[model samples]
Target: MFKLITELKWSPDGCRVETIPKGEHEDLPERAVEIAIQLSILDQSTGGPNTGQQPEQPEQPEQPEQPEQPEQPEQPEQPEQPEQPEQPEQPEQPEQPSKKVKK
Candidate 1:
C-alpha cells in the first residue's frame, strides 16, 4: 500500500488549496475547512468527500458550567447595632439644714 500525504495552505485569495500527489485529492484538515468557509471556498459539495466532518469533534462533554459558584449567598449584610444610651447624671445632694440650734 502506498502512503499518501498532502500539505494545506491558505491561498492569497483565501482558498483552502492543497499540495498533493498527481491524482490524490481527498483528505484535508477541519481547520482548512473552517478557513475555507470564512473565505467562501467551501460549500455543500467541497469538503464532504475531501475533508469529511472532523470525526464529530468528540462532543466537548458540556462542563456543567461550574455550578455558578453558588453565588456565595452574598455574605448577608451584617445588621447595624443599635446605639447605647448615655448614662444619666447623678443629682447633687442638698446641704444639710444648718446644724441644729446649739444646746
Candidate 2:
C-alpha cells in the first residue's frame, strides 16, 4: 500500500502559505509553495468590497398620442338633356293641257 500526507504552513504575517509533505520527510518544491501562497492571497481579497451594491438603471421618456381627423361628404349628380321640335310639310302645283289642229 502507498501512503501520502499533506501539510500546510502559514507565514507569520498571514500573507503566504507553504505546503509540506510529512510522511517520508521530503521537502516540497519551491514552485508549489509559491503557487499556494498566491492562491491564498487571491481568496482573501475577493468578494468583500463589492457586497450588496447594485448598478444604476437608466430612465426612459413616455411618448404622446396624436388625434385623428374627420372625413368629408360626397357631391350631388348632374341634370338630363331636353327633346327636339317637329318640321312643317310643303303643297304641290297643278299641270296644264296641250291643244290639237284640224286637217
Candidate 3:
C-alpha cells in the first residue's frame, strides 16, 4: 500500500481508463507503482533520486534585531571665507599735452 504524492492517469489494458488522485492507494498494481517511482511522484521517505526542487522552508518567525547604525560623523562646519581686501584708488593719468588751436 503505497501513497501517490501526485496525480496519476493511465489506461490499463488499452481499455479501462483510470485516474488515481494523490493519496494512499491500497490496490495500485505493481506496474502502476513502478511508474509512480520512475516519475518521482511516489511518497517515499528517501525521496529516492528526486531531481525536482523541494519547497523552501519558511524563515524564522522572529526576525533578528538589526544593530542601530552609528550616526554619521557630524560634518565639520565649513570655515567662513575671509572677506577680500578693498582695492586702492588708481591715480589720475597726467593731462595730455594741450593741442595748440590753429586759428
| Top-scoring candidate (TM-score) | 3
Q: Relative to the true structure, how large is the alpha-carbon lDDT of every model? A: 0.47, 0.39, 0.70
**Cα misplacement distance, residue 86 of candidate 2 (Å):** 95
Candidate 1 lDDT tens digits, 1-103: 1113233354434565554242234554555545544444444443365444454343343466655555555576877766985578889999888878877
Order of candidates by TM-score, top first?
Answer: 3, 1, 2
Local distance difference test, candidate 2: 0.39
Model 3 spans with C-alpha error above 4 angstroms: 46-103
Clashing pairs in 1: none
User: What's the TM-score of every candidate structure?
Assistant: 0.26, 0.16, 0.39
Clash totals for all candidate models:
0, 0, 0
- Find the 10 residues in a row with the least total lDDT in model 3: 50-59
Candidate 3 overall Cα lDDT vs. reference?
A: 0.70
Per-residue accuracy of model 2 over 17-58 as CA lDDT, tens digit each: 654443332233434334433444212222332224332332
* lDDT string, candidate 3, 1-103, tens digits: 5678888886667789798899876667665666676677888763433325442442334688999998998998987775986588899999999999999
Q: Which ten residues in a row have the lowest lDDT in candidate 2?
A: 42-51
What clash count does candidate 1 reach? 0
